[model samples]
Target: MAKQYDVLIRLLMLGDSGVGKTSMLCKFTEEGFNSTHIPTIGIDFKMKTLMVDDKKIRIQIWDTAGQERYDTITKQYFRRAQGIMLVYDITSEISFRHISKWLDMIDEGAGSVARILVANKSDASALRIISKEEGQTFAREKNLAFVEGSAFSGDNLDEAFEGLVKIVMDRNKKDIDEQLQSIKLYGSRENSTIDAEVKPGGCCS
Candidate 1:
């Protein structure tokens, strides 16, 4: 049997309410964005396949409702997530300030998974409350990638997603390489049976 080349990466989008999480997901997955305020009641999900670094990656993106009551329900989706996007509204200082709590939730629920911080609504420079430099500094302090994007104008939205995919791929490659090295080291021993257990699901599903 030939080895399969399917790679699934689960990504979760989290942040305060009205930070454009749904818009960003729609823009990335379908290249469309709606201006209406149809808040996500529980969780909305979308999937897209892309070629990243010559590998076919199936990205399962989960957009969770930002309401306080949905925190418990949202946390359940974090365990298997390979990457997370901690987004904030660039025009709203309150939303931008709440990133710490969101990060904490990600850490507590997602086991400190790989994440990127994004400042949305970048198209409105005049109403911007969080500057690019500030967001970049904050992201660097937390060792997370940062980008200012706009789902409305489609600025840097694709880059933000592609960047996350690259991160996931790199980490997955490193883990596989480590396992292969361990196998090589142990398999060289005499009369040793390599009992490898393959998991049913990939990173996403």
Candidate 2:
């Protein structure tokens, strides 16, 4: 039987508690959001399949517990992630401030994973403290893709995940191309060496 998906990507959600990481994941995967926020435990994952440019992609989004007590457990998931959403709540300045700390976590645990800075709760414009410019500026400074949207309204959620997927896929393609090129070069070099060592005749000659 054929595989269910052409590509499999593991994405991780990292943010402080109450930043709407779980809501964002649920909204993207389940197409619904709960107004009542229930804190995630150590870790939980949701799977969603999407098609990008004719390739079926299976995304496994892991939501990590934001509370400090679960920090150790959350760190273990980072290494395996192909992409990460560093989420923050627009209404909460503290949450926005914590994004840098989350970046530190990514640097330490995630290495070079594709990342996007997600500012959630855009529907709460009245309560929002972090301006769009600030989010964009920070994302630029950190070299991360940025998207500000609402899990409640479902704005830009699809773009956020799809953009990250595109980044990962492009990186994967580039890496594969580089490996193939290297293999071809090595083969050429080995063939040249063999031809040079072999005299104009048989091995016995």
Candidate 3:
């Protein structure tokens, strides 16, 4: 049979309420955003397929509610996540400051998933409370890819999703290589056992 390539990557978007987590996902998947506050109730999921490095990657993105009360509810999705987009509002300093707490929750729940730091609402440059340099520095400190994007104007939104998919694909490739090596080792051991089990005439006793 011809080799089939199907890679599934689960990604979670997290941030305080009104940080555009849902809007970002909507803009990325549907190419549009809503102006009203349609608060996510529990968890909303969307899937998109992309070609990364010539491989088909199915991205399962989970848009999580930002309300603190839903923290426990959202934690369930983090366990199986491959990548996480930590989002913050550029115009909300309080939201920006709470990033560490959110990261802590992810660490405790999701282990060591690949992460990207997203600064949303780039269209509101006039009311920006967080600087790009500051967000970049924080992302670097946390070892995350940084992206300042606007879901409203649709600027740099594609790059954000592309960047995340690239990271997830790279990690998946490494994991697959390791698994192949392990399978090879196991096969070799099985072959050795079969060789020893054969008699001089290749007949079993």
Q: Is 2 or 3 the stronger prediction by TM-score?
A: 2
- The ten-residue window of minimal lDDT in model 2 covers 196-205
Give the candidate number with the greatest TM-score: 2
How much lDDT does candidate 1 score? 0.79
User: What is the TM-score of each predicted model, taking all chains together?
Assistant: 0.82, 0.84, 0.83
Model 1 / residue 193 / CA error / Å: 30
> In angstroms, how far off is 177's CA in candidate 3?
6.2
Residue-wise C-alpha lDDT for candidate 3, range 161-203, written one tens digit per residue: 8898888767778874564466545531211211232222110
List model 2 lDDT by residue over 1-205, tens digit each: 3446555677888999998888888788777777776787777777788998886677777788799999998888788788888999999999899989989988998888899999999999998799999999999999999998988899999999899888888878876456446645553121221112212210000
Q: Which ten residues in a row have the lowest lDDT in candidate 1?
A: 196-205
Q: What is the lDDT of candidate 3?
A: 0.79
Q: After superposition, how far is residue 186 of candidate 2 from its true place, in Å?
A: 27
Q: Once model 1 is optimally superposed onto the true structure by TM-score, how far is the C-alpha of residue 34 displaced, in angstroms?
A: 0.5
Best by lDDT: 2
Give residue 129's lDDT in candidate 3 (0 to 100).
Answer: 93
lDDT of 1 by residue, 67-165 (tens): 899998788888878899989999998888899998888889987688888999999899888889999998989999988999899899999999988
